[model samples]
Target: MDLFFTIVAAFTIFWFTWTYLKSKGKPPSPPGPRGLPLVGSLPFLRPDLHSYFAELASTYGPVVKLQLGSKLGILVTSPSAARQVLKDQDTVFANRDVPMTAKVLTGGRDIAWNPYGPEWRMLRKVCVIKMLSNATLDKAYALRRREVRETVGYLYNKAGSPVNVGEQMFLTILNVVTNMLWGGTVEGEARASLGAEFRQVISETTELLGMPNISDFFPALAPLDLQGAVKRMKKPMDKLNAIIESIIEQRLKKEKESGSSSAVEFKDFVQFLLQLKDEEDSKTPLTMDHIKALLLDMVVGGTDTSSNSIEFTMAEIINKPELENPLVAIPTPRLMDPTLYK
Candidate 1:
């Protein structure tokens, strides 16, 4: 019975799209590679989506239009088109397309994936004022400096040995973020468990989020479980949610014991959220789910991006050995032009 229903829905969607496209007067969007009917260009998408899009742009001019399943996607490769999207029509394109994996992993509460509306606005404001504002970031700078110093010490201890720079960089960034969010460092056995959990959550989330799942574009056939990708993602999402819930419960218990008026100095993200929860905001009550989602953003956005950039910088330096020579011969800042000093 479910199969029959899925087939009927798929056919209905196809027929509706056919009629809609026929009624449109605009020339069928810019030309690009042809794809299978119903599924469209999804099959062609690669793990490295940026490179795939770049290749298509080279073949079909700067702007290439393609249909991913039933959804229309326009890839702009030209600098002018990028500027237009970023500056001229920024608000129009501000909202993101959240994939199924992201929705499940974040429990549909992350600000990055939230649709543009009141909730998004409220969350964005909270993030700016409580989390990423200059003052909050400045307060965390000492934590960052301490983490970097420890990392340098570790490298010094491993001198003359071939170091796994990737592992070291990941630990350095993770320690910094953990300190900034939890008001303490994860060390000994706790550090190992935290590192393992963090890496598993981050790695799985990125892989699932980036994968081309047909159900996202062809929503009518979602229940069919055609690709089985949705089923595959369930375990990791559950694990991530469990980790987040445990952290939240621990923080809440600690807050309760400390009492509401206690003047405990907090230099972490979780403490900041707990403080916000105490405020009288009837309009936007900070629910458990909201706290979990914010933590997800802090872990995913805060740690992964910075660590990746650090890896990239290391890789670039390795590729050009000359760049490393200046570190030994002269101070790092002296390499920069004095005229461009900010």
Candidate 2:
């Protein structure tokens, strides 16, 4: 037992020393707050990530390198630095370092996490040209108008009463997206149930995505799920996956019953994807899994971003009387308005 302990201690020291020496020889990494051993800067991470990054940028240069456990986090603060990475050297920086939770959600198949290659290019083309082209957006304008009208009517009914602006906007955007995807197929009781379920899961998902997971920083420790972040994230993701699967099954059933003659009547994104899947294509043949993953991206991305923007804009208008009457009002820069003041 004494010999075994000595051997373990020696091995540990040797590994640390070797790693330290190897890193020492490399070109100097960007400056940031010093981190503790093994866990790195995780313990020092603040709840306000944006503010923390800002502080780091102020202390360091525009580009700050943070030691996040076994992973390296590069923070780009300046617009020029960001442009360089995103445009000047796009191909080199195209690949993403996907987290454990994201991998579980997408199976590393979705365009967001997929590596820079033919598959990603194909997926990008499908999304840009076929799904979200100008023609498709023009056709879907009516659906968006209908959902917006419904929301306006609801707000009008509750005129004086207090309303949860964010919640309402989220639901409105969610329905608009659903209608565009499948012509608002899930309706009445099922729609209510689905909306509630989706809201809960999406909230959980976004929270989990932002969290600092140990598994994300350390790949070898992912299977162990030390912080249980991956496990927690998977629950909501699985529920979402099941919902997508059920929708796909119902669509398939309808298609089978309706036959090929009704194929031309297909209107929604799901129908379009299904049709594409059936068509003989040698390059980047669409699969059902890919369809589901893309749908997940649409729901998660579309709802949160649009709803949040609307909510923020509404809040700004309500809180600031200067912008209350925008058409005739002069733009006075508020201390809070970073863009205008800066």
Candidate 3:
């Protein structure tokens, strides 16, 4: 019965898609696979998507058009084609078909998924001119150094125990990022627990973001959420948002108690953004939602990318000491006959 229902649904969907495409009269798309109307190429997709895509590129041209269920996928294989899409005519491809999970997390307000427009331009300006300026980063140098010292000390203390390099690096990087964003929002004993909880949430969030959601490939079925990607994402996303909200409230409370006129030192991005929110005289003023979204971007995007890079590099260095550079090596004696940063 279940199989019968699925088959009926697939046929219905194919008929609908066929009618829609026929009505549109779009130009001849790139040459590629002629998959079955019922399932398309979804069944043929291998677990290693990158290699599978490469295999397809070998058969088709650099630009391959794939019928992925209800969605049309255009795969760019060659560097020149990539350059044209990403650089030459970037505006044409600036907007992304955001997954259901990402929409839940950032509401398409964050820089990563926001479409290229005035608002996105304003966001870019805020991030670049405020958070990523040389002066801003220069101020953060002390925080990074301090976190490094603390991590090394902890490693020194736990000399005999088995240490997971990736996990430790994640915590270190996350702490540094959170401090830069909120300036000691979670303090003392709770900080350790927060790190563990945050890491677990982040790991789950990344997994959801990467997972192939039916909503992504079949927009008509998105509202149904047959896979529950959006549902699974909300808990962690909400927790992270709650944490950000608490930090914002605390900062706002401090402003109210101290009085806004009083000289409050801008030690972190939260304070800076709050101040900017009031003072911004632009046509599209920065709202609290945008501020929160950007914070989510940094926490989710920055820590994960940096930590994973460090983790992979450390693993390679530990495996073959010859690749160890003084800057990013693991320490000696602990993983003896191994190289770490000097």
Cα lDDT tens digits, model 3, 70-130, are: 7878999999999999999999999888889999999988899999999999999988987
Pick by lDDT: 1 or 2, better one: 2
Per-prediction TM-score: 0.82, 0.85, 0.86
| Rank list by TM-score | 3, 2, 1
Candidate 2 lDDT over residue span 1-342, tens digit each: 999999988987986897689789699888877776677788888888899989989998899988888888899999999999999999999998888888788887898888998888877887897678898888888877766666676676687999988777888788888877876635566766767678779988988877777778888988899988888988998899988888888888888888852456646888877887888484778887788888888899998878779889989888897888863455644422433212
**What C-alpha lDDT, on a 0 to 100 scale, does residue 284 get in candidate 3?**
81
Q: What's the CA RMSD of model 2 in angstroms?
A: 6.4
2 or 3: which has the higher lDDT?
3
List, residue by residue over 1-342, the lDDT tens digit for candidate 1. Answer: 999999988987997798578749967678788776667788888878899998999899998988888788888999999999888988788787777777767756779888777777878888888777899788888878777776777676677999867666777788877666776688777776777677767877777777777778987877876777677778877787787777767877887887752467753677777767778375867766787888778877777777778889989888999998885687656324333222
Count of steric clashes across candidates, in order: 0, 0, 3
Total backbone clashes of model 2?
0
lDDT of each: 0.76, 0.81, 0.84
Clashing pairs in 2: none
- Relative to the true structure, candidate 1 reaches a TM of 0.82
